[model samples]
Target: MKYIWFLPLSLLMLASCDDHLLGTTESAPCVRQPPLTYENFGLPMIEKNCAGCHSSLHAGIDRSNAPVGVDFDTWDGILLWADRIHVRTYEDLTMPPTGGLTEVELDDFDEWMRCEVFPNAERF
Candidate 1:
């Protein structure tokens, strides 16, 4: 009887020790954030997000060479319309018409607008 009780007690102690060794824990892979740049954020995002409806040969909304009413094909044109884009897409979330971009991508765009796109605005 003593040995039988000892075995059960030892098993319980071992289980408790195992639980302590494997305490609550979490692990997530580190995500390497891509560098924000014109090629990465500006060109690709615009091409994917806006070019379909705002490209050239589409009348007043073309975004290609002629850029319809708001040309974003050139650096100068992009600089000119940066504020409008920001307002429509970021502030109001009305552009794109399909789905909105992720907050990270939006932040990248906002940073780009503040740094490269709108700083050299002729009106500003």
Candidate 2:
């Protein structure tokens, strides 16, 4: 039937893993993560995938593509935006502006943010 095509399209649309679809920001956090620490995982992963657009300065290269006032250059800066990072990365799953990272990297990032637990139960 002509209407049958719409079924697949609707399914595809609903499959988008965005958090907004769930109607709440307080979604389930990730479990089954590796050791959680800035020195161990956060720094290296963020630097490789997020630093280009989020750092203080990167070889004086123009970074108009990224938003201003949100620097991920240091642990403190990353901590400041950790909530947003979790939202954008895990909930919305829409960040890093450009989709430069491979699927493995994205998976790793998502796992780290969600499953990776911090001491004292900190957010980042």
Instruction: Please name the candidate that would achieve the greatest lDDT relative to the true structure.
Output: 2
Instruction: Give each model a TM-score.
Output: 0.57, 0.55
Candidate 2 residue pairs in backbone clash: none
Model 1 Cα shift for residue 11 (angstroms): 78
* TM-score leader: 1
Q: Write the per-residue lDDT of candidate 1 for residues 1-124, one digit (tens) a residue.
A: 6578888888888877622112113211222255455676788888788766665436642433333567565566666677678777766787766667898777666666555555455454
Error of 2 at 33 (Å): 9.2
Candidate 2 accuracy as lDDT: 0.63
Q: Which tens-of-lDDT digit does each residue in 7-117 have in candidate 2?
A: 999998889655322422353455545554667887898887678788888534455566776788886776667668766765576776655666666666655654442
